[model samples]
Target chain A: MSQYSEDSGYVVAVDVGGTSMKGGVVTRSGEVVATDRRPTGAEGGPENVVAAIRSFVGDLAARGSSLLGRAPAAVGIAVPGLVDDATATALYAANLGWRDVPATGLVPLDVPVLLGHDVRTGGLAESVLGAGRELTDFLFLPIGTGIAGAMIIKGGPYGGTSGWAGEIGHIPVFPEGERCACGQTGCLETYASAAAVARRYSARAASPATAERVAALTAAGDPVAVKVWDDAVEALSLALATYTLLLDPSAIVLGGGLAEAGPLLSDPLAARLGERLTFRSAPPLRKAALGVSAGMLGAALLGWRAAGVPDARASWALDVPKTSAVP
Target chain B: MSQYSEDSGYVVAVDVGGTSMKGGVVTRSGEVVATDRRPTGAEGGPENVVAAIRSFVGDLAARGSSLLGRAPAAVGIAVPGLVDDATATALYAANLGWRDVPATGLVPLDVPVLLGHDVRTGGLAESVLGAGRELTDFLFLPIGTGIAGAMIIKGGPYGGTSGWAGEIGHIPVFPEGERCACGQTGCLETYASAAAVARRYSARAASPATAERVAALTAAGDPVAVKVWDDAVEALSLALATYTLLLDPSAIVLGGGLAEAGPLLSDPLAARLGERLTFRSAPPLRKAALGVSAGMLGAALLGWRAAGVPDARASWALDVPKTSAVP
Candidate 1:
């Protein structure tokens, strides 16, 4: 049943979100040999989530060993929060109700483990393997459950002081807009994130629906859907225009679930961004190529980097793999 | 008599603003040996302004030769607008009525000549010799005739592609705000810039006053002045909060004419910035130490760098000379 060669090497890449933990055993060239997904059970509290993460890492290592006839060379985990990646500490994750959680120490594996910010890791994957492959300066914004940004400057991710750069979601768009859960008012995410889109539409629509369904309804010319969607687009444009004037990235890569709506999101967002700008031209708006897998793959890239693999060698994974290399 | 020796090297520094051109011959440690000032004559057109800059550079070079017994080693100039620092071209300066002007080529100097964007050069000076000394990450905002920023990341200036980064003035702070000269509505400069503050006050008050006088009137409880000042503070705080969330700088350094008001700007700005931030802490706000001379001093630093001077050696000029090296 094992397909991987004993001579081959691999790393465990995991993305831990509010709802679930997704992981994979990835080869040096970024090929995913196998994957595992499970509920985070955050409602049970921080201890339960930590235990789940530990068990998942163990399960992946065991699975990799069984499939490859050897243990993984390293492990990388991506988690949301104000993470201090250097110390592998999840300083705080509001969604998970945890603080100062040492995520790296949770894993039982003997191999080296690295922890990273989930959004930044996703951005790294996009920067190297997906939409931002050739861009030296760009922003990878994932409009998933919430909106955050991964700033790529001079071909690498820029983590501002304390590794908390790119918290663009918290930036206020409307001076007197609605209050945010973050104790702030009129945050960009409150108006434009996937969660926001669905919550707003559901509040007024005759039939409650997810952001995806709202997009469909909007396309059908439902006045309420159209109005909500347009407001979201406008808010996003204003925030992005602010970002453009400050950083002037070459392009913006939209990722996460909302980005999956394709042209429906990209077209209007791009046009509105253009209208918002004055003298400065808007960079091309692009969709993420790797979809939900960007975070997992980005985690693998971080692992490979931690393992001291050269960027040139790491980038070889971008080419479609011809085989599993398990002979 | 010049204190610099015949053997000692020097650089000519010029800061070209919309209304005036300030130039000086500076010793390596940032001491001004000889100085000259002239009207930019921008109203006479780009060609006239170009002639003034050439004369200023030439005058400083001659003054340095006569004082120090030798010509200066190099020259550095800082000008406004969307400067292509790499090409040393003034791409477009609305105030100067110039487009695609070769600034570096205009200065008929044999030694190496360096040209930089005016605000960025001032930021460089602050980073090395003024308030931001020893700080690794900070933003240098000079709110004078207009508001522009110089971003210092990892101890050096970050000029985005084409050297147009830090154009924070253009960022729309008000959606339905006043129309800006740049063809945009409700830009940050439209409300908070030094020029805007004075102009807005003059439009409302029976007697026209500078931003400094407006600050005094606001302190005296003049309702109109208080209202205008509060609006500017709010708009500036909003922009700064956005910046803080995005970059998380260690500090924010305020420079230029408006900054000269000291506590009037810093106190309200710090308090408002603190109020606007939720999870993130506000970076300490500080006034620029070098005052109006920051641009000229930064230009000298640039020249010294272009002339192969190390930072350690370049800083030696900070020590006031007891006697001219010419002795």
Candidate 2:
């Protein structure tokens, strides 16, 4: 038995990562009709990755058709790249080695399609229904293997003049500190990212350790882990302090792997951020509500937007907190 | 006596600074029919300053009436400190000792009025008819006694979530460096501001030197002057690198007293800014075109905008480059 009728409008939404892609059949009413996850085939080539995405979109649409008795009205995809929204093209994706892929070329059907930057699409989800729901302007930072910010300005993601905005990870925090892999000195990512935390702790401890393990060790009063964790917090506080003074965002929403440490990260970051900012009060720190599903759900909203349903998220009666994880 | 006819419309424009206030009558054809300058009366307090502003606005409008044979269409003012655009209130002025002075209260006429923040208003002039005329997104940085930036986004000045967005001066560039007058450590203003440059040079050279003298000495290969200038350039490079990574602006328009150093300041800053960025090209640094008259011109535009003449700068040609100095 289906909750949606045969005439219910639906769209195909996909979130494409470097390793894998997640595709879903989303109805206009915000129901997830079906979802499928698969490898992006990026190791083969850009052509193979495009083929994988096309196949995934077709498969999801077919599943949606079987459930709703109709083809998808439109498609929306979130990809790791610099997107040219005016031309509906993915300008470049460093990880996937893809460039200038038109939105329509990725879909098998004759439906309209939309494409967005991966992190910014996730920020859209956070802004619409996640942690930044009430914030009109804020920074959405996902601290994982890497760090980048989605600057949600005036209720939407601001990509700047050339869609190269929000590259906060590369901003130099310690002007005289260690050299970054990006060839810059003292980049915030060199000390604060999840991978960085793990690497620094492992190097000091003379043993391999994950960022999670390092966090656990720090909690258990391990000296090396504590030092590494403290450095991360200090670097983040400096970056956040700079961000606050320049942009004056109402709040800063934290996401991705490191945020999962909960109070361990937020407590120290908040204290130092306050100390660094002398004139203005630091913006409140918040936990991301949607977690990993943010990109897919945001793609769904994009799908509905492409289908000409601009108020798609408005009618969504979702219980996001209750269904935190999707299996 | 007047160049224009009786039907020619005009507006009163004022730019209020910490020490002095300038007033002008701007015709619809972009003509400055009359101009006057007076002290802001800050020595007597906020009330006297408000009275001075009110008297200036009335005098300018009366002169405009004599030329155009009608009451002025509207008034526009640029004031220091925080301004609330929505409520048309000068929220606070630290130097002038004023708080929440309404725009209507500053004008003694039955005409519409508008207000703008001083530096942002100057940026608006640069954006409309000056150096940044062709740019839609850029930064207007004035490194005077103090430092601040006017972030022009999407063809207008963006004040951010709380109208405090462009505090680029206060961002901590050197986390463990010297404390600033604002009580922050390693703030960009502490190292890069013209006042800071002069003060630093005087302290090291055992003699007082203006920023201009420091620039000349740096050019003449004085080691102390070179070191102080180098530190300023280094701090600027770090700040600009962070801004570029985060915002991706097209260009940076340099103004204020330090910028008058011209290539002496911009050349080294440009080279260092380029060196700091590892992933992307640095935004080109351009000299501010309007020099000191930017605020008054922007006020005139605001006056036109208040009079419902939105595209006020479309007609009436003026050679900005040739007429660098207003007097």
Candidate 3:
């Protein structure tokens, strides 16, 4: 823990979700200190979301200054959408109902503020500090409310030619299978996301129970739960197999909510990927280590870099706020 | 012709096919001169192939020296195999039965000799000079005896993370389709390649005279030929659509023998791709302008670049060898 305070420059990392906004004072080594959260206020409009973020940042800064006696060097924010990192613009966010949100300018920080897609930022975190630390090439699949991914190539994330490189979720996995929110039919996300798993369980058993209970019942040999789990595993495996063939990543880092299922997901997914791969070496499937904090940690790293810190290694020098008393 | 001579230096480009070896003295501007050809003598082994290539080069050098009043600056060879341009090693050549053939060392020329894959070399020519010249991001899909492609990204070719990036033919188009020579089943090459089309026509029609006649009959509305043609187009379209979704190239340049079908191929492919692509912009389907000489032109450009020539711009130089001279 003493290693956490070696460098004392503040960087604000914010995770903007559909329902909530999470902000934190992240150390250079990816440790989060003085964290705060608030409702996204997205239903109220873009201005409300911006206000919430501003307040969150203000609160975080005040806490940091009171504790550490200095202001943050930069801020990094991660949001769910088609982010044009080159232009510092959120091109579109279907879930948040925001279009062309100039997030970089909206953040009330004199310091440099960097913006990136939520999944990509999570992938960056994985690449720098988690299972993908040593991998020069890998794919980060965040299986949450919606399945989307980011392609990590030679230690850098590929945003595609149009900042839409890792839209693998929208790729047609089962043609003519199911309608997706992206207006596509049979997308990989429709079958493999956590939402998909819960939907599958509900549709099969007509159960009103939470997905957590479904996981429990499936563990105890509930037939409908078992079927849903199996289908989710199969769908995930198919998508993974396709990714393996395309990018041939060193590994597939599974993150987000559904990955919490652990062996229930990894075991069957590994087996299915093995069955499909013939000519090439099948990549090892691993669970993401960072959990929910990945986005924050990644955003912090991005913020540090944006502040001219250079690389992920430099992120370790971030200043931690020294509070008079532990919060 | 005078401008071609002034713009390009004397360089020799060789296209090493399974059955034949074609060599030509190409100017820096992509014009061919003192062109020569000889049988590959593949059965005589790597040693014999080297001897044959040397003899061909010797003949071409003598003619080019006399014609241009100097020996060519460098030589570029395009072969059918996995070529490592960095190491100047041909990793594998199934048709030539050569593994790790160091053709660069084998060449007796004092000038630099650069080696590259035929399809990739062809793609380079197309991207720099042909239909894809204006597009920074595109895919060059050449469907000859076999189907393969080269991805052009940001004005450069991506040799995959493992230098095997352009094996688009091996990508499974139909999971339950026919077995391919590469040990995969239902590859696009099995149905879409020129050889596949000819084989399908020969097998089904039984009374086929030649591939040309079959093509003519197909154009004349023969039922058997039409079926084979339609299936070939469908397979090619599916492959193209998959590529469009994956890379989202600006254009899909159709080369090789089947591309000779012109509108017969492009119109249907465009329609299929348009139907498949929902959110993304549909890339234009166009014919490769360089034709057979595309390989030679690419080889020459590679040689020029390898030789450290200051102003290597072979693609833009209008020195195309007439089609009638080769095909």
lDDT of each: 0.82, 0.90, 0.75
Candidate 1: DockQ?
Answer: 0.72
The TM-score of chain B in candidate 3 is 0.91
- Which model is ahead, 1 or 3, in terms of lDDT? 1
Candidate 3 regions exceeding 4 Å error are A1-7, A28-31, A208-238, A312-327, B1-8, B201-237, B314-327
From the highest TM-score down, the ranking of the candidates is: 2, 1, 3
- Model 3 docking tier (incorrect/acceptable/medium/high): acceptable
The docking category that best describes candidate 1 is medium
Clashes (backbone N, CA, C under 3 Å), per candidate, total: 2, 0, 7
- TM-score, candidate number 2: 0.97
lDDT, candidate 1, A83-103, per-residue tens:
886787888988999899875
State the lDDT of candidate 3 residue by residue for B111-164, as single tens digits.
Answer: 888888888788887877677877877888888888878778668666655555
- lDDT digits (tens) for residues A171-266 of candidate 3: 665555788776766677887777887887888887666556677888899999888787777667656666666565778999888888888778
In angstroms, give how far residue A324 of model 2 lies from its true place.
7.3
